[model samples]
Target: MSAALPQVFPHAGLPARVTVYEVGARDGLQNEKATVPTAVKAQFIDRLAEAGATVVEATSFVHPKWVPQLADAEDLFTGLRRRDGVRYPVLVPNPRGYERALACGAREIAVFASATETFARRNLNTSVEGALAEIEAVVARARAAGLWVRGYVSMCFGDPWQGPVDPAAVAAVVERLLSAGCQEISLGDTIGTATPGHVRALIDTLGSRGVDPARLAVHFHDTYGQALANTLAALLAGITTVDASAGGLGGCPFAKSATGNLATEDLVWMLDGLGVYTGIDLPALVETSRWMAGHLGRPAPSRAVQALTKD
Candidate 1:
């Protein structure tokens, strides 16, 4: 059977290539009610790499008490048969988590931060400034060890408890991450309430604060059915890196209203139509997500995956 593909229609003023950071294994599965086996997580990472994902977030090193779904972090990382030219980054929430990631030989790591105080307190068990302090220490030590570090700022667009976050406030967090030696920062719409204009305005605000758009990545949730539109806005604003999950499979564990991430297949379909290079095979990616959906005992939430896979 022949596979379906998007008709290319090049859009001007957009990047020729965009990096799709695959987060299914880590962020996507972290919120699951049932535990995904360690071996299955390893296989999922391998499948994502086979489908041409250059960067895949493997697992989180946070304590098992916080996120039990990924408690097999050490085993998963140890057992993973890594592919060459593919980068696998792990999340570290504090010094203890960083030590665990370092022990697992992670080459790249990410730290999660919150732009609002309420989110910080709820997610990180600290105030916004306090979380930044911890993240600063982790990033500093990781950089010293010659590992590449990425920073994630959650609730950049809106907070469930504190609605409609200010762009300036998000930029402040971005500045702190940059100052702390993070190579890149992903701005997350945790509750998915952002629109295209808000995305553009936030990028502009970050730029005005002397932060380059190149160092920024967008992580949008599809709660408001606006993830793709907001992503387009980010692309037009010269942001080339996008964070997506394989099956639209992740939501903020701390924030009840935040939905699944912008699906990888859906994002790839859009990029394919736009004539932007992502180097991922759309058919293979769809198949991988379908396989993962079966493991989860649920249908994939990605519209592209659903439409293309329907027989």
Candidate 2:
């Protein structure tokens, strides 16, 4: 059984253990210009699980028209190694995608809704309410299949077209996803413009709406170099789950100007030093990122990985 890292002392108002939700294989690679081979993607998932990632999102079931890179999701899931305790969830936009994910043996699924109507239209060609309506059905169907459901609220903080967002608006979508039977909601900082104060306020808003921090996860981007700081705020606000991509991979496809995700390696390093257990193998994780970075023909963006692997 996995154990929490030993707490050296009492951490006032901080969680003892945090679950790092690794999205490297799915969220990390979805936006890449070069399409990764099916075999390579499977290998990456295996490596992530071997590095002690209990929840590794593998691939999305979205249509090829939306993300052609993950067109081989079925093939990737069919022959990949399944770790005993690790969960591999696929993104499903609608019922058709959910059905495809189910056929590929997916036991957990994720559906995303946007906070702003503009992002809703731009990302999925639907209004916020319309997207939530579709996700509700997907969640209901997946729950009926006894599959775990995760929901994502995109553009939770600020949007490119619609500058500055109301926390209540984000919470409204989150509530709809939860009412549809999503066990957890990931509030996504799609444009990477959220600050620590913004994160705290958003969490407070959700809390005020009867949403516990336990059922929430923070997904941040490093576009303005505030991802880690914002994450610290979430941790202080009692958030236990964090969504990160290995090697800091991934950028918003809809919001092209945004930078990559907050690197898992960087988050792990901070948590380790803070005595917050994540059960991740730091050196092994770094090695995997370096290897994956080599495949991308670039140096790893994670400072932790680069520092640990520096010549």
Model 1: CA > 4 A from native: 1-3
Model 1, span 1-311: residue lDDT tens: 23578789999999999999999999899999998888888999999999999999999998999899999999999889889999999999999999999998998999999999998888888999999999999899999999999999999999989888999999999999999999999999999999999999999999988999999999999998999999999999999999999989999889999889999999999999999999999999999999989999999999998999887
Instruction: Report per-prediction Cα RMSD to one decimal.
Output: 0.9, 3.2
What lDDT is obtained when candidate 2 is compared to the true structure?
0.90
The reply for model 2, stretches above 4 Å from the true place, is: 1-10
Report the lDDT of model 1 for residue 290.
Answer: 90
TM-score of 1: 0.99
Across 134-189, the per-residue lDDT of candidate 2 in tens digits comes to 88888888899899999998999999998999999998899998999999999999
* Clash counts for all predictions: 0, 0
Error of 2 at 284 (Å): 0.3
TM-score of each predicted structure versus truth = 0.99, 0.96
Best-matching candidate per TM-score:
1
Candidates' lDDT values, in order? Answer: 0.94, 0.90
The TM-score of candidate 2 is 0.96
